[model samples]
Target: MRPNYLVIILLIFYSCNKIETRDEVYPTKLYEKAKYFQNENISDSAFYYFNLAKNDYVKINDSTGASKSLVNMAIIQCNNGDFYGSIETSLEADKLLRNESDSTVKSTLAANYNNMAISSSFLKNYEESVAYYKKTLQFSNDAENRYIYNNNIGDALILLGQYKEAKKYLELAIFTKDSLIYAKVLNNIARAKFLDDQNYNPLPELNKALIIRQNNKDIEGQNSSFSTLADYYLEKNAEKSLLYSYKLLETSEKIKKPEDQINALQRLIMLDKPNYLKYFKRLTAINDSTQTSRNKAKNQFAVIRYDVEQKDAENKNLKLRDAENEINIIYLSFGLGILIITLIIGHFWNEKRKKSIKIEKEKEKELEVKNTELRYSKKVHDKVANKVYHVMSELENTENMNKEVLLYKLDGIYQISRDISYDKNDVALEHNFSQHLSQMLKSYSSENIKVPIIGNEESLWEDVGDHSKVEVFYILQELMTNMKKHSKADKVLLDFSRENDLINIVYSDNGIGISEFSPKNGIQNTESRINSIGGTINFDTKTENGLKITLSFPAKN
Candidate 1:
């Protein structure tokens, strides 16, 4: 009796491992042909093909192909509202592909991480989404892929209520070379800005995103951009929101994406409940077709499973002795398989080394080009532009100088030279932080403007790059220009300090404070520019003196 029980247990275990299926020629034919399905509206068939491909790859021992198929299936699952299932499948693929050092494999791994993040987003697990997106950045080295991953990271952070961090990553992603990524990053940033209460209006960021999407002719991106802008203006400008929603509906129709069309129609319905019936009917038809197709595919899968089970039973009954003899042959085949795998591993290692060398050379070439551009710009500013300014200065200071005449002539020359040299090179300000502050103070030392400078010069320029120096210059220019024009302050003090990784800049004047002022056009422009550079600005209006502005930024490299 005990021996019989042990045999029964073994049989149950083998049965559990077996794939149950139906016994019918039509079902088998359908199962095989299902692998070729690729209909946009038929999410079920697409999902079925994805699973078939994954199983096919596993049978062939192709890890990379299996991972790809799994990712594709997860994408469809995400679209069909099975977000948790999608996340699980993506995680399994990620684990299998992690050991692969191939860039193409790594790219797929990054994509899996991105899909997992999207699934997490559907579940409203913002923190987990952010964590997975961060993982994507680690695996993705391709510039275009990195750009999208960075933007997704920003979007996830924004959803987590980390506005400042979201903006920082979004700026980096937008600064990337890919236009599609740039446009998408801009849209995400706009959403973040809209969420931040500090921003009175986030229309500018939305407009910037719209312009970029339109310029790149990204229809999907454009659809998103228009929808966002429409929602944004819905509260403040109802007419504008309605107009953009209608425009988005037209674009969605042109693109022929049913889901997007459904979204646009829904948004239009919200704006105009009376006219929405036209779009609503179309949306319902598409949605119904999608659900029907998915149901049919699910039913077919059940049929295939039943047929496969019957075939396994018949094959097992007819080949019991043959399978026992083949067991020894399987052991022999496994031994040779291990040896072949070892050789393949060795080949892959050498190939990876060669690719790394090529990548290094390309990076070096890019860095060289950037350095050459900076050097050329420095030469033009230091030699050509500076000399012209000096000659004009001497002419103005001469004994019989015509002040008005010299001033007008110098202004034209300055404008013309600036235009000519603008593309040649960027102007580098004084590298010493203290000297830069002093120059700013001197520039505002006229009868109407008084700015006292305070900062140290020790080692400020030692490790800093031209990028940081230029940012400081632009900040100073904007601040002083604001003070001179609007502050009405007769006295101003500028303070600067560097502590650890942070740089602090304080500008205060004895003029009219910010309470007496609204967001000046200049202030708005400055705010946008400063945000683009990943810096924060706080306006202290409680001061009885002039407006006090505090600027903090990460030290430039």
Candidate 2:
């Protein structure tokens, strides 16, 4: 009886305190205020306060609050045409939340990549956009994020002229559980296939997207699908297209997406045919702007390629001139040697003819001296040259020796055998050299290498002597074998022809090429083999194709 009023007073005070506690615990006043500015499309104030609240949440270590703020800021940036800037902020948020092991960070990354892809599409950098969207697909772990990223990739691929690949990605997107994302992917696929002359229409996909948006009460998505579909049908059904376009225009105006409104207005002009001159002017203006931008980019890429080609051509010309000078020096040396030998022979012949009566005793002395020198020269050539050749061939095949090592060996061999020659009087060098070359090619081909020898039956050597045939065959064999082992070719054709006194052997193949012809064993051997007969070899590597070997020989009487 003494405490009844006191207990009643205490109970009232406790109830009021509990209400205050609840209010302090859930203080959504700032969030509500920010949402108002966002809904009003006032981006400047919305971004400022969102940052303020996001910083406060970070100070309090509130990850959920921080994430919401970041998402809202990103959406605002996307609406304001600062797409790349938005992606930068989104990635920062993603990194923070990923360190916290948040699952939603993956979805956020997918969203950022998708936004980047859309911006890049507007820029018409399809390759770069497709690459970004692929990263989105890789990071999107959940079904919904996967569906969105897949659609993003599909759209980029379509713009890149990769319609076949786009179709597969789009179909996979549509099969996902997120009906809204699935519908968007389907629309992209259908439009892409239609543009590519494939058997698919976008109307069904657009309608499906509309259905999902309507059911979910997603007005923005509904407006986008309607606008796209109406623009699509504008060509075939003018009245229906106009009706849909009007609906989209009204919805877009309410949502305050000015770009979508502009698009809808353009479509209306197309379908209704009202203000025809104005529509034509707008389209012309857009086209001119687009073409100007495209020309700038195309010119930039072309300039890079042109500069590279110019440098390459300049280098090649210098090399060719040096090679020509070397060849001239070699020819001059051979001419001088031949002239000296000829004069000596003529002098001796004249002396012998003039002294024929006295030379009977002198002839015996001359014969013995000539025989001794010939025997000594044969012994040196057979033993020293054969042993050197065997050692060089062994070094050439070893993996330990690099290209420079092999080149050094070939140069050494050239210096050592500088005086060797295939003269007409060498009977061993005279034979069916074309047949011998074909047999070598056949052996290479039997080892599962693609080596084809053509023009062997057609004889360019019909009138040429044995020395010429031997030199030509040796050079041809070396060139063909080099092409087979190094060129990685599937087919090789060798053409031999003779025009008057000059004989030509042309060897070409469809394989990887030598850019400007780096000197290899095959090349050195062929060059040495040709030089032995006083012939020349010229070869070139065509860009991205294969090697072309040309051999020229002077026919003897």
Candidate 3:
């Protein structure tokens, strides 16, 4: 009993799947239905089904199926007088079949090229039509299609007024086994010859073509032959011309071709017939009706394309929205994970930063204590020790030392200590420090030495800070004192120039240059003062040339 129940359940599932499959319509079936409607001359129904088949094939990734449907729809559009629309559809089919290997697809591509040629001809683009017809011949392997395309090229060339060139393709088309196409080519060649030369007689060829079309029961071909014959006799034989025009009108009416009917009516009106007014009214009515139908067909095609595009856009938007939703969910999860990890790291980083700051504060306190001790030692050496040495030298010279000399030495000691304790210097920080520097250099100069100052411009020191100005004064004073005591300099050149944010001072003297001289107290003191004000000094001295010192420091604004 359990086995029986399982078998029934499986059968029910299979039945349901079969029903779902049967409900779906295949692209091939849709294409067949479109072809049937196209052959029945129901253009709207044909276009509707062809578009449906094209969309279905695209969904299934079947490019060949879609291309075939596009070609058929192009034919319908051309018949409805939508030449531009037909050309676009044919081009789309050609693109889809570019790399196709199937013989049927190749044949369809050739047919599509031919359709584009025909549509271009109707649009009066004769040159483009001829080019498209040549392309059709290149892709066509069938003799009949090749002959037909050659004839099409010939007709377009004749319309372009190339009578001599058109003869080649017309003669090629005349060799086809298809009697109807052969007859049409004969008529076109006759027209080309007639237009090429005024004395050319096309009556024989035109009459032969008309008889052949009649025998083959080719109604469209017969209509074309009659029209050509009418045009041929229009200027030569009025009676024959009237007769052919009437015959064309009768044939066009029988076939329900309004364009042909209108052309015949216009020819009849031009002939000054007895019932010209009646034919004129009929021509106007047929032209209006034809134009209305063409407009309706164009609008219908536009609406169908719009609807398809709207549906495709809606489907694409739905897919994009779904993808965005998934991306947002992923971002939310990732953001939460990053936030939790950042919080954990930040907690530990805060504790580590606190410990580092505490250690930095203890080191700063130790550095401050060491700096204070160094400052006190420098003060003692500069003040008390130097003053005590001066006192001992005075005591050693006891014969020359008196009460006045002792008082003078004590006063000098008091002045040295006072200078160390004070922050200000009366002479060094004076506004006339530049004058004092000039006088000091002049005092070192004598009859044997020359000191040439290049720049004594007051503006050079205008941007210099007070502390830097005092250092500069003392440095120059110390250099001059050394030159007088040791270096027997002949000439000195001092140049000062301010560039950008720096001051450059160059000092060169022609003196007996010391080769291995050690820096004494004056030189050491000059280096310390220069460094305190963020300045640099370079000394250049050779065996006998001279001493050239180059000094550069930042000019404080």
lDDT for every model?
0.69, 0.65, 0.80
Alpha-carbon TM-score of each model against the true structure: 0.45, 0.38, 0.53
Candidate 3 segments exceeding 4 Å error: 1-25, 100-102, 313-557
Output the number of the TM-score-best candidate: 3
lDDT of 2: 0.65
- Screening candidate 3 with a backbone cut-off below 3 angstroms (N, C-alpha, C), the clashing residue pairs are none
Query: Looking at model 3, which ten-residue stretch has the lowest summed lDDT?
Result: 1-10
Better of 2 and 3 by TM-score: 3
Regions more than 4 Å wrong, model 2: 1-46, 49-72, 88-108, 118-126, 198-218, 234-243, 277-557
Whose TM-score is higher: candidate 1's or candidate 3's?
3
Tens-digit per-residue lDDT, 490-520, candidate 1: 8888787875567778888888777644675
Q: Count of backbone clashes for each model? A: 12, 1, 0
lDDT (Cα, tens digit) per residue for candidate 3, span 318-365:
866865665555446556665666678778878998999999999999
**TM-score result, candidate 3:** 0.53
Candidate 2 per-residue C-alpha lDDT over 367-449 given as tens digits, one digit per residue, 9 for 90 to 100: 88886665445433432443354445456545586778667766755654553443223322434556655765565453335
TM-score of the candidate numbered 2? 0.38
Candidates 1 and 2 compared by TM-score, better number: 1
